[model samples]
Target chain A: MKVVDIYRAIADSTRRTILDELCEQNDQTLFEICARLTNNHGLGLSRQAVSQHLETLESAGLVKSRKEGRFKFHQIDSTPLDEITARWPADASRSSPDASRTTKRASTETEEQS
Target chain B: MKINWTSIFVTDQQKALDFYTDKLGFVLKHDIDMGGPRWLTVVSSEEPDGVEIVLEPNSHPAVVPFTEALVADGIPMNQFAVDDVEAEYERLSSLGVTFTQEPTTMGPITTAVLDDTVGNLIQLVHQDEGAQG
Candidate 1:
């Protein structure tokens, strides 16, 4: 398994947008991704530039590409981000109603595991 | 002078003819045998006299690799205008056609990319009324 540095992968705004698009709909070809960025986001980037961004995301394990028939499609894999949430205790964050429920749920899950 | 004809390199003319006519609903405009390859062409049923799409053969040494690279990158060699991209996507998909990119809307234009099954990717585009380019 490849170790993913989630921070580095998401450092670029374009890469983050790519992840957001993939999250909205998994499995998009490179051309589709480029079109979305240009049409939806108004980011008129060249295909080669977007391809390099995908490479960086792939290296971080934040993105995966699969060959289907004659074309290739890209997908998002955010599992590498688990390390971030795991390293920092969620309960320690500022008080929010959602956070309180999450803390309680986390404790409940821990109790159940024990 | 008006642009009357455009060519697309096809891996096989017979397959291209069937796919263009039967699958895409294009009308065969010309099919003259040119010894080794045919001077094949098809036009949109909606505008039979608009522009003829020449289904040229990809016999040249550089043509195969060029088309392959473009297909691999999901780039369309040619694009056709349609009234509704989503409808066409649904119709073509039901006919066992493979799409590299599903119908996606951006601003006033919606587009989809599909494999022509003859060594090229073709785009079907639908632009909202009054939308330029």
Candidate 2:
């Protein structure tokens, strides 16, 4: 996952709270999320504040919002990133060998040419 | 600007916390519960206030599988550069940090692989000066 995407999704404090709420129970309307954050988490945030954070998280693919009747519901959408990072193994010597491995041919060639 | 660390969901958040700070000597940054699953972040003492690792709970279907695959493959989610991989490995071993791969040298680089309990394969590597031959 892009650092920017993760950072953008998590930069806001309210959005993190919203994501935690969704984890407990997903696909909740704006009012449900706001009530939980206000009453339970002690965020005491307004509904508009929660919506603004949801908008940013939706843009970053961290959360998805759906329109249901007059309500806009939001849920965590964490499927986009899989195997976000992979790197080649770092090893020099494979076995316990007595002699060092080197490009003998290259050294010999350069010597002969010189 | 400091990187806001990383947030990865784990099946067991407490285990992840112990594996990071207790075993690996990372400083505990945050241990707050937003609402549901507990939230935690650990920062390496080597780079305090730099970049930390957030221990998020693995509840989402996709995140759970993604973490499982990485663990099954024994692929470290990330590698950390260290001044001494062997010494760090030894220290962590004393703290009961089980290493999947022992310290092995490759040319001028040495590395050790260990499990972070959060379904992550973490590597500690030491690169000598001018190893790119």
Candidate 3:
């Protein structure tokens, strides 16, 4: 899952709700997913809207789907997500106090060049 | 209006399940498996139709980003309407839940901040009956 793609998948409140419902169950059919989302997640989004969001998530590779006869189960794709996070670029959000590591590293390179 | 489904993002679904169902007295509505992971949702024991609070795993990149940013910036998520903020704060504290910030009264609203065992900051607000006046 690309970081930007995953970020967009979670940007919407309704999509976030759907993701939570799917994660709670780990897997759910399209109908069950929609029902759980409507009943348990208060998505209030139309069935069509829910399907659209599911499509977006599926397209982003954040979720996996399988067709079982007439049903489709949705769940988190841990492998893709793990790989994406593993390759995350350092930002100020990290635990370390020194977030200027990037600047520091650049200065060291410049010194070596000079 | 009856709410049948609801979802909540959490760092650990199990702890959240225990907190809502056990401590808050919400009854377990459905616990089923989608496949590798199981679905667990609870309803208010008193008002099942009011709202569904879904217990969701914290895996979404945006959720992670928003929660971390909020924490770094110091803001609480949705504040839960409680009968008594201090009592809820104390009861929750005994359950091993940490209150990062104690109940502080700002005029009419008395609120306490609690760490919901995850990145989320849950708030208990005491609706000052007189706050409106």
Candidate 4:
């Protein structure tokens, strides 16, 4: 799968939450994911819907699943997130000049509008 | 204290990435394998270290209905600042990017809206340099 697919997998808030659940407690089943989402986040989603979301995340390489007899377990793999944090240099000063200029202009406009 | 990352929902990740990088001129900032789905992100060439835009998948049960409502209403999921909206519009148009709203000056900012091809409308904006402090 391409890198873009990974981005697509975590874009949705629900999927992110699912990832978070897996992160908090790795190797969970579909029923567990749904339970946590509803109990903790107040997001009442159907088992089928949550299953589909898991499939999307799985296809993107964010979620991994393994079958243990009759139960399927899902887990979160966070290796891909490193790439996102690594994209920029640690120093904020390394940001391009265009960004600063735009920020300055935006602030100036806000002041003028006020 | 600062906004570092933001994302928009897309119907398809690969298609969104191509349009964003090839047509919109963003650079791929990150793409890594996470065992199941890869972690992917992009940044503006002008601000590689600034805010990162994530092309998130709209696969959640709630995303489809919400995104559809936004699309039906012609609302842009997010906005990006450009040096010149008209010039960017022309460049993207040449690349076959479809715009729902052409560049039009609205007070101090000139803006245009375009289809992101991933189930969202994205806006490109320009602020006159001369108006800056």
Error at A98, model 1, angstroms? 20
Q: How much does candidate 3 score in TM-score?
A: 0.48
Where in model 4 is the C-alpha error above 4 Å? A1-114
Candidate 4 chain A lowest-lDDT run of ten: A86-95
- For residues A1-35, what per-residue lDDT tens digits would candidate 1 score against the true structure? 45547898798899999999999878998888998
TM-score of each: 0.88, 0.50, 0.48, 0.51
How do all the candidates rank in terms of TM-score, highest first? 1, 4, 2, 3
* Model 4, global lDDT: 0.76
* lDDT, candidate 2, B18-122, per-residue tens: 777778778888889788776788888978877878787777778867766555434466778898898998888887876655675644777767777666667
lDDT of 4 by residue, B1-133 (tens): 8988788888888888898899888999987777755567899998889888877777789998887665543456688888899999998999898775567564466777777888887878888677563
Every candidate's DockQ is 0.69, 0.01, 0.01, 0.01
Worst 10 residues of 3 chain A by lDDT: A66-75
Candidate 3 at B48: error in angstroms? 2.5
Give the Cα error of residue A8 in candidate 4, in Å.
48
List model 4 lDDT by residue over A28-67, tens digit each. Answer: 6565566567767889998779978988888877888886
Write down the lDDT of every candidate, Cα atoms only: 0.91, 0.70, 0.67, 0.76
**DockQ score, prediction 4:** 0.01
Sort the predicted structures by lDDT, highest score first: 1, 4, 2, 3
Candidate 1: which pairs clash?
none
Q: What does candidate 1's lDDT look like per residue over B48-110, in tens digits? A: 888999999999999999998888889897899999999999999999999888888889899
